[model samples]
Target chain A: MQYAIIGAGPAGVIAAETLRKTDPQGSIVLIGGEPEPPYSRMAIPYLLIERIPETGTYLRHSPDHFQKQGIEIRQDRVTAMDTPNRRLTLSSGDGLQYDRLLIATGSRPIKLPVPGIDLPGVHNCWTLEDARHILRLAQPGAKVVLIGAGFIGCIILEALAERGVDLSVVEMGDRMVPRMMNQTAGNLIKRWCEAKGIQVHTATRVKGIESRSGPGFLKRVTGVLGLDAESGSANALGVELDNGHRLQADLVISATGVQPNSEFLKGSSVELEQGILVDNRLRTNIPEIFAAGDVAQGRDFSTGGHQVHAIQPTASDHGRVAALNMAGTDTLFQGSFNMNVLDTLGLISSSFGLWMGVEGGDSVEICSPEKYRYLNLEFQEDVMVGATSLGLTQHVGVLRGLIQGRVKLGQWKDRLKRDPSRLMEAYLAQNAVL
Target chain B: MQRSLHIDPEKCTGCLQCEMACSLENEKVFNIAKSRIKVFTFHEEGRFVPYTCTQCDEAWCMHACPVEAIQLNKLTGAKVVNESVCVGCKVCTIACPFGTVNYNEDSGKVIKCDLCGGDPECAKACPTSAIAYIDANWTGLDRMRSWAARTDTSARA
Candidate 1:
């Protein structure tokens, strides 16, 4: 049998590798839009900030290594797919037939719909190219304005601040990382950013960007207009107010968020709601064609509803399920656990599982501003459902397992809040089969 | 003998250890989004470049800073941002050509690399030695050595 994987990202690569292992005689074609080999997307921020070297980002396998495994990697974008014909047309105008197809196109950054957004200084942090451009624009003492207070935005903020770049973050939400963390956790991060001299403007909406234009060149960001929260009115550039104000910046980066890159399948028969819809078996409505990674929408582990797009681990898991079924092996995609580990400014914050909407759930909150530590745990019916920790994230693995496994609290219920390690040990001992 | 952190982008793997170390040392968080050193990746080119304040002898951020919030740390040769006196006017942010300086909305003050009081945590934390503290005058020594090695006939001939 032959397998064709569209995308050389984590999901596609894993799927190809898994298929190769399952069927050594099978032919595999790995198509990727990125010119380089598959690498970690999560590591892009660190690469931009000079934490790790470029060589370290490359996958363990080289192009030749894939060839040895009988996996053909074609570096080109798939413009269209004829699912009925069992063939694909690439941007390079090549056609290939496949017994089975896996679509793992991943995601593209969401662009802001503001005027002058197409200006030279505006950038979206999605690909390595975006990182390069953003870095090139960053100089000593340059004014930088970041739109979006999400993970990417916050990561860029931390990196730039360390480089001596004056940075400003404009978040539409009332708190930083609202989607990932609750107000309480958000407040802790906000305080940390403030302490580091990084200005964070929340609950403010950006109206448009003003660029300095005139001559042949020298186009730089003059100011940003937005609504101030306190005054509830339009604010001018450089005018400081509670809600909004104009910020003059040399470069403007939009780390807002990303949407699944499923635009190519617009005319196709694949079901899509933000992303390609897949069943628990990781198969799309169309038989033979499978979708995974950011492009594939699957059931949420916590909510058990159709949710589009998860992080890297989820994408990898999706790839495994898709590959197993493709290789004639029966496998079901369980689901994904929503987790976030963010270290913003001086605050290390991590959250796992469902920490929201437990009306009468048993809860424990620990806050120590002087020590810069905060911990919050929520339990439902004597079972660990979700947890949040700031500054000290040593017990993340223990918490993650408890939430993922839905382990019984039983006698260790009281010890859960006070000593996470001890409670984890006792729980493991009880669960360990003699 | 003032030294600045030198970055070799080719060595960067994008682990973000530098960002974590810098934030922990300065802001006490693992937030890479607010770090002083920034990394840029050219995905198509398969290149990762870490960028930060070069701490030029004639620093524009220091001169353009209206309230003098940006000052040159004579000991470390870093253009440091003083949070206490900073008015958050962002004049220095616009003046710099490289767009390194930024305004912090949370603190209402501008932030920049202060060289971690001379022992730069970013350089130390870089696992791959992508970032290093080298002699300011001999920053190009690595390139020189590479060229010199290429001239040797032992391997080529």
Candidate 2:
């Protein structure tokens, strides 16, 4: 049997590895669109902070790891796919046939619809190549203006701060990580960033990006005229905000958000909603084809409906389950929850499940902004449906366990409402009772 | 036969011998903070429950690892973190429901119970048999035996 997996990200790599383990004799081809080795986008921030080299971003350490396992790794893009014939057309004009196909194409960063968004100094910190470009431009004392304060934006904010760049963050939302954290928690993170010498502009939008001609531009002119001068010297880019304020920056990194890379499936009979729709088994509308990772809107733990969980852990789980069914093992994928644990400039925050608190659901919150600590629990009857906490890293996984396990808190619900910090005790009590 | 680490919390005395032994075995240190097995002190209940990685069949940390840094020890059925490969993303630390996977600031890699490569030092150093390396299939055998003995009416005055 031939298994062809698209997009060599975390989901694609894990799917390929699981398939090899499940069916040793199967022919596997893992196709990655990028030219570099299959690497984790999660490691790009570490790469920016100089914690690891470019090669360290690779998913596997050994260069011959895939070859040793008899899994073919192809660096090519899938331009079109023929689901009826189980065939794929590559960007390089090559045809490939497969008994089973897995789409783990993942997502791409969304560039804002602003003027000068594609200038030389503006970039997205999504790929290894983007990281390389960021490294060259994000020099010390370089004025960097980052657009968006979402999960991806805040992560890039931390890395840019570590590089000693004069950083200013602009978020269209009212606070940082608006999607993950509630208002109280998000504003606290903003204050924490401000305390660390980084400027944060919440409730703001980038109107346009204007290129500034200054001393740096003269250097570029000199280099272009065959003078023995350095080329591509950084110049300040004016980031005009909706607030009628402009900030001069050497580099502007856009981390607004990402959308599933399901564009290639435009006319393919395979289903596509916000992402490719799949069942609990991760099988798409077509039995022979499957989808996983950010590209697969499989299941949501909180709502019991299909939702795209664009997190790494979900992608990992989706990959393993999809590979099992693809290998004819008949595995069912229990849904993935919306969970995020973020450490921004030394402050830790996390949210799990329906952190926003469903309507008609009981909620409890304890906010100590002075201590930079907060905890909010959303309860549907006696069960903890979701929770959000800031600066409480110890044993925080109990929140996830309670929600994911759907444990009935019983009397512990009242106890938690009284004292939200009793999560560890409540978790222990529930497990002991079970 | 695959063996697993079995914990009988009732037998624990909170001596932290397992913690010290674990730290020494894996980190070459005597610091309990470096130990994979943690002894939580529930002061109100007057209990000390020692816990670590369960080496679960569908290990969350193992599957959740983005870089495949966490691998299964085929000999021991233990999920071991490959430090050279781990980028210290801390995703695994949160992915684990039991919170057994912990991040080490000193090494910048997450640490967890590797069962000491099958010969677990924590089980050996446990003074009260609170931690033991037993048959994976019969980890509940001891509890079952105790319950069976409780129902014994064969000889009672």
Candidate 3:
């Protein structure tokens, strides 16, 4: 049997390794688009902070690890896939046949259509190439304007801050990480960043980017006179804001969001919603084809409805389950729980499952914004459906345990309603009873 | 036969020798904070329970690792972290349900119990046989035998 996996990210790599272990005789081909080795985009932040070298971003360190396992690694990308013919065409003009295919093609950053976005100094911190460009311009004291304040953006914020760049963050939403965090929690993060000497602008939008016209005569004259250090270097970008303010930026990082890289599946007859729709088995509507990672919109643990969880944990879990089924193990995928744990300038915040609280559901909150400590619980009857916490890192897994285990709180629910900090006690009590 | 570290929480006296041994063995430090095995104190209940990586058959940390840094040692059945390749993403720390896998901020990598490559120091240092290195396949055999002894009428007399 021949297994072809596209997009050599975590999901695709894991699936290839799993297939090798499950069916030793099967031929596997893992395809990646980048020229470099299969690496994790999640490690880009660490790379930016100089925590690790380029080799550290690799999904596998050994140069011949895949070759040793007899799994062929191809650096070409899929141009088009003919699902009916069980074949795929590569960008390098190569064609391949396969018995099973996995679309782990992940997602790409959304490029805003504004003018001057394609300029050299502007980049999306999505790939290794992008990180190299960022490092060249994001030097200490460099004026950097970050486009979004979401999860990915916040991570980039930490790296940029660590690099000692004069950073300014602009968010379109009312608060930071608007999708992953609530208002009070998000604003607290903004305040924390502000305290750490980073300028944060919320409820704002970047109108457009305009390149500073080639140094004017006076500026050129100043450069010749050795008065203006940055003059005659024509790469400075002017970021126009909706609020009628313009900020001069040496580097502009666009981290607005990402969309599934499923454009190639336009007429493939494989289902596509927000992403490629897959069942609990990670199988697409097409029988021989499957999807995983950010490209797969599988089941949500709390809602039980199909949703795209583009997190690392979900990607790895989907890969293993999909590979088992691909290898004829007949495994069922447990739905992914929606969770986000973030650290912004030393303040840790996390949210799990239906943290926003369902309609008509009972909710409790303890917000000590002054101390940057917050805990909120959402409940449907007696069971805790979701939880969010800031600065409460001890035994945080108990929140996950209670939600994932679907443990009934019984009378303990009332005690928790009075004090949500008793999560450890509640978890231990439930474990003891069980 | 593969061996596994088994912990009987009841036998624990909360002495924390296992923690000291684990930290010293893996991190070359006496600092309990650096220990792979942690002893949680239940001050109100006057009990302590020691916990670490179970080295599960399908270890979540191994699969969750984007890089193949966590690999299984065939002889010991221990999943060990190759720190050189680790990018310190901390994804495994969240993926682990038992929370045994943890991030080491100093090294910018993760650390977990590797059973000391089959010669577990925690089991050796436990003054009270609270932790034992036993056969992996028969982890429950001792408990089953004890129940059998309880039901034996000949011994009861």
Candidate 4:
């Protein structure tokens, strides 16, 4: 049996490892689009912050980790797949046959439809190569303007701040990390970034990027002539916003968001929603092929339907579950929990399950915007279905415990409705685990 | 069901024996920093809260772990971290809203209460019976029994 996995991100690497463990000599071939080793995108921020070297981003530290496992690590992208024949056509114009194929191709950062979005000095902090380019331009005292204040953008914003760059963030959303966090939490995070010397503009949009001439034009002339342009072009870029505000920037980083990298799977027999649609077992409509990672829209626990959870943890879990089923172990995926934990700057916050609260569901919230502390709990019937908290880490897992266990809060449910801080006591008293 | 650790904060004496025993049992050292179970001291309130990993069936730590470094031991039902496999990204630390999963910089791995591979040393070392390893199914029985006893007013009469 031959197993071919696409995209050497966390999902691809883990799926390869799991397949090898299940079927040791199955002729496993791991394919990566990038030239580098299978590295975690989560480590890119650490790379930018100088926490680790380029090699540290490699998924397996040992020089021959994959080779030792007899897994062929191919640094080539999959242009398309032929499901009926169970073969993948590579970008290098080669075809490889496999009994099973796992599409672990993750997503790519979304570049906005604005002018000068692709100009030099503008980069997306998604890949290692992007990190290398960012490291060169994000010098200290360099004016950096970041687009989008979402999760990816905020994390990159933190790293840029650490590099001592004069940073300004523009978010089209009303607050930061809009999708992951609610309004209260989002606005609080924006304020937290502002406190950290980051100028955050909420509910803002970039109209266009204008390349300014003057010293910058002369510098670019010298730069194109193979001479050091130096700081001349550094101040040559200007960002115009819909709010009639113009800001000068040396570098612009786009962190708007990402879309599933399932474009190559287009026109294939495999199904595609916002992502590649997979059943609970991570199997596509064609049993020979499967998809995981951000590309697979699996089960969403909160809604009991399919949704694309593009988080890292989901990618890793999907890889393992998909590999197991692919190996004929007949394992079933238990669906994904809506778990999101964010550490904006230094403040830690998390939201689990149906965080936005269910319709006709009872809810409770305690907000102290002054202290940057908030707790919002959502309950359906007697069960706590979701919770969101900020500035409190101690005993927060109890919220998840209650939800996962479906622990009947019993009489303590009323107590929680009164003072939600007593969740720990309720968890202990109910002491339920499912 | 496997046995689970039952903690009673009222019975705790603010002792550090659990920490010492935990560190010594797992790491073979006397360093409290290496201990998985932590006791938070609320000096102003004169209360000490001892906390450890609950090892939930679908643990967030296990789910959030990108490397599958955190696994569930079917026998003990404890979520154990495979140190060798862990990249020490500390995502589990943040994923754990309770803050039980902590990072050890020396090993570049996140350490959590593994219940000492089934036989927990903290329960054995507790002098005041603050921490007890009991049947997992019946940890809640005592609370339920107490509530039931309250419903029986004949005993009070």
Tell me the lDDT of model 4 at B11: 81
Cα lDDT tens digits for candidate 2, A192-310: 99999988999999999876764456457756776422124454578999898999888899999999999999988989899999998899999999999999998887898999999
- DockQ-superior candidate, 1 or 3: 3
Candidate 4 per-residue C-alpha lDDT over A62-135 given as tens digits, one digit per residue, 9 for 90 to 100 = 78998899999888888877777888889899899999999988999997999988766678889999999889
Ranking by DockQ: 2, 3, 4, 1
Q: Can you list the residue pairs that collide in candidate 4?
A: none
**lDDT of each residue in A1-434, candidate 3, tens digit only:** 99999989999988998899999999999999999988988888889999889888888888999999999989998989998899999999999999999999999999987877876578999999999988878888889999999989998888899999899999999998999888888988899899999999999999898767643553566567885423234337789999888988888999999999999999879999999999878999999999999999998889989999998878887887899889888877768878777767667788888998999889899998889999999999988999888875445655766787676888778888888887756654555511
Q: Candidate 1 has what TM-score? A: 0.68
Model 3 misses residue A175 by how many Å? Answer: 1.6
- The regions of model 2 sitting more than 4 angstroms off are A214-235, B15-35, B41-46, B105-107, B118-121, B141-157
lDDT of 1 by residue, A1-434 (tens): 97999988778877998899998889999998987777656656556667655543444324477877888889998888898899899999999899999999998888877766765667787777777776776666777888889877775666788778788888888898888778887877877887788888888877777654421223222223342221111111131223658787667788778889999998999899978999887889998999998888987777788887457656766787789889988776667566666656536566767876377787777878777687777888878788777765322344555665566777667765665534334334334310
Cα deviation of B95, candidate 2, in Å: 1.3
Q: How high is the CA lDDT of each candidate model? A: 0.69, 0.84, 0.82, 0.79
Every candidate's DockQ is 0.01, 0.23, 0.18, 0.14
Model 1 Cα shift for residue B101 (angstroms): 36
lDDT ranking, high to low: 2, 3, 4, 1
Candidate 3 structure, TM-score to reference: 0.88
Worst 10 residues of 3 chain A by lDDT: A227-236
Candidate 2's docking class is: incorrect
DockQ of 3: 0.18
Candidates sorted by TM-score, best first: 2, 3, 4, 1
lDDT of 4: 0.79
Off by over 4 Å in 3: A214-235, A363-371, A392-395, A410-425, A432-434, B15-17, B20-35, B41-47, B119-121, B137-157
